[model samples]
Target: MVLEVVGVSPEEESVYRLLVTSGRATAEDLAQRAGLPAADAARILDSLALKGLASHTDGTPRLFRAAPPDVALLPRLKRSADTLELARLEATRLIQAYQDTMRRHDAGQLLEVITGAEALRQHLRQIQTCAQDEMLWFCKAQYVAMPSGSNAEEFEALARGVRYRVLYEKAFFDDEGAVDNVVAGVRAGEVARAVPHLPLRLAIADRSVAVFPLVAGGPHGSPEEPTTALVRDSNLLAALIALFERYWEDAVPLRVDGSDALSGTDGSGPAEALSPTDRKLLSLLVAGVADKAIASQMGLSRRTVQRRIQAMMERAGAETRMQLAWHAAGHAWL
Candidate 1:
């Protein structure tokens, strides 16, 4: 009833209740009963007195008491509270209106080009800072190599409790230093992984923003010179996430052996083993690349690539490329 009339909080109400129940009490006495410190109780009492709901007698050690039940200030205090609440709500609405207008003006749609390594770093920093839930990335190990005086900012972000997931090629296992850096993040419970072979670098933040390089040549491009597309549209982010899921499904968990090595034991190996070339071919097929492209990249003719893929699929006892990718990934074959 007091809060409805005078806009006091529960803590203040407790202090008032203590004074009323005690008839008259010192600040120290009220503090002990209300489970607050003497200083806090004194402040509450001062606020109540200023609102004319309570007062302290000017005697030795000072004693606080609630105002008389029939005090004429009750209605006046209610009126003052109502007026203050109205002003607060009006100011809140005005601030919200300004924020909505700014959002309308700044909302972006099309993909923006981000060129050069320094620019990429800045863009990544923005995503890291803005992330509230999760960050998913597919990157080459080389892209994350720290330069002189450059901190492992990405690792630091993960350490601060950002959920991170990364997909990278199997070659990352060979770079122990790079692998260790990523493993530190994993130990922090900030990361999950998919491995063996990831394509172009892709990053999505909080399911609201995405970044990926427009690989003109191939995956081995210079980190300091790659071109990127930075997208902020929800639809585009969804598409990118879907793509990541597909790749993640076909990638290996980074943990190998009992240790954190790339080739560590996740569980059982494939029912059937495959050569490195077979693994490579399977990855290419699952990615939806044409036979010609696979042939060109692998230095083989279309017919030879097709024959090899056919043999591997049959050996794995799989029918479709999708099934092949699924079983192979499950068994850690590719």
Candidate 2:
């Protein structure tokens, strides 16, 4: 019993044995039997009393006796030990959280310059390949309009049941080829949409990583002059996803028929609602063509195309070309 309380110490067991055999003894008698000093025996007796394993009787000379063995003390001791360990673990977790916050504060802005079109393409492919559940994209028409190897990879991922939600500009409706591709994707039923003038080009995969263009303009500039950033941190990715959802809430739906209607206008519209020049400009925008390329294609000055796009923004009530495209596509106006 004493071994269970104080562990297997030679002195404690010897003292317990002396107390048991002698029935009750003075500290001096216990010390002689246990081969320990009188002061040592007194200290051990006090420790045993504190443990409730033994008691000292009050008399002319104090004498110790082993208490009735209590089976309940073993489980009580174990529970107390477990409670203390849990408190230690909780304190460690709180300290780790504080350390992580300090680390983020110590490291401010982080930037990396990755060169080459192929490098950029590979980076996008890597994100798609690693996506386990869902991929959300807010893209300009130019990204989907222009042919690239990444599209094939993205399509393959969709085929494997990786969920996808993409937003495109109204200009996509102007390009028969681009529209056809979108229709095909819609047929697959893996992608959902809101309409057109998407200014920000962003991609999020599985809530773990995000990619976006650094340059303010759409991708229609030169591929050689592309600027983008890929983010892998979870907190930053969540913030980016939140921003995308805010824009998505105000966007229009992609499908239009008797079933789909804007509150103010009837489903039917005049042909002049969108002119040929407007359609052409939208296509160029989706293709990520520069102002010079759009101007050359339409036989108009670059400034004219820019002005028309500004006018389109006003007509669409859009702040950015990306938002304009999203709204246009959703309304089926583009």
Candidate 3:
């Protein structure tokens, strides 16, 4: 191991050992005593002299001698130690430099792209799970909310005392089981609203971070290859939160009271028929919100909300949505 560390082969070490034991001798005699050929002895001694392991006299038929073991070996070992120290110091500097570069790269990367459907789900679940206070979300596309039964993440957040506010677009209710899923959510304690024309699909957890689709083509309901984004604190995130609030102000709450009055517009335009939830839905419609937007506010399926509107129109004996609204207002349906 010592020879290896010192970069000396076994044959070279043997020759070096022989010279060290014998103190001084001519090359040919040393080779004969050391079991080496004359030519081999000359070459080795010459090589050892160059390596500072041996020295020779200036006389003819030069007399070769081993260097003082203490002097020769100590300086070589010291050089090895110095080289090792320099390498260690260089490794430490490299590690520190790598850490700094990674920190800068991470700091500058506030937004990250996530591809594929299942990957998007994992990211959503992690974000929701980490939310400490609240989660704000908008679901305008089915591709984001499909296979609808995987809603345990939201309930888990609610269980953790995180307030959840979700906005579902009117079209979101068109899915077969969307109304039931939302009703289940309402029972689980999330405060949900429905709106007709939500801008895009998004989920923000703790107001510190957001996840959204970086979808190509259009922002709503495209079933193409899914690509999502993780957005950290930034002005862009602030605007996203602001956009939700703006729509929230006009959203309708989901009321599953099974009230007869809410389902029908009284011909007499009576004051007692509508529940607060019912009134909110109609009010948004009267204020020009589309069915999809109303569904978003209420978390009911778009189809469900449309059915309610159709029933209301039938009760008012109106042929169109606009007429039904005018009649309800004339009669004070709320």
- The most accurate candidate by TM-score is 1
TM-score: model 2 vs. ground truth: 0.44
Tens digit per residue, CA lDDT, model 1, 1-334:
4564556777877787777789998999998988898899999999888877788889878988888745735676768878989999999999977765664576544467877776877888788877877888876555432331243556667667777877766565455476666566666664445445666778898887898876542233453466788886546668899999766654445553357664322211353334466678778887889999999999978997888776656655779877777877777764
For candidate 2, the lDDT comes to 0.66
Instruction: Give every collision pair in model 1.
Output: 256-263, 256-264, 256-265, 257-264, 257-265
Q: Give the local distance difference test score of model 3.
A: 0.75
TM-scores, all candidates, are 0.50, 0.44, 0.48
Q: Ranking under TM-score, best-scoring first?
A: 1, 3, 2
Error at 140, model 1, angstroms: 2.6
lDDT of 3 by residue, 1-334 (tens): 3664665657767888888888888998888988989999899889888888899999989899888878877877778889989999999999977765664678655688888777877888899888899999887746553356576888898998999998777777776677777777777887877765677788898888898867743322555667778887777789889988866754656555554112111112232444455567778889899889899989988986787677567656889988988887788775
Candidate 2 residue 293 Cα shift, in angstroms, is 51
* C-alpha lDDT score of every prediction, in listed order: 0.69, 0.66, 0.75
Instruction: Kindly give the number of clashing pairs for every candidate.
Output: 5, 26, 14
- Which has the greatest lDDT? 3
Shift of residue 183 alpha carbon in model 3, Å: 0.3
- C-alpha positional error of residue 75 in candidate 1 after TM-score superposition, expressed in Å: 16
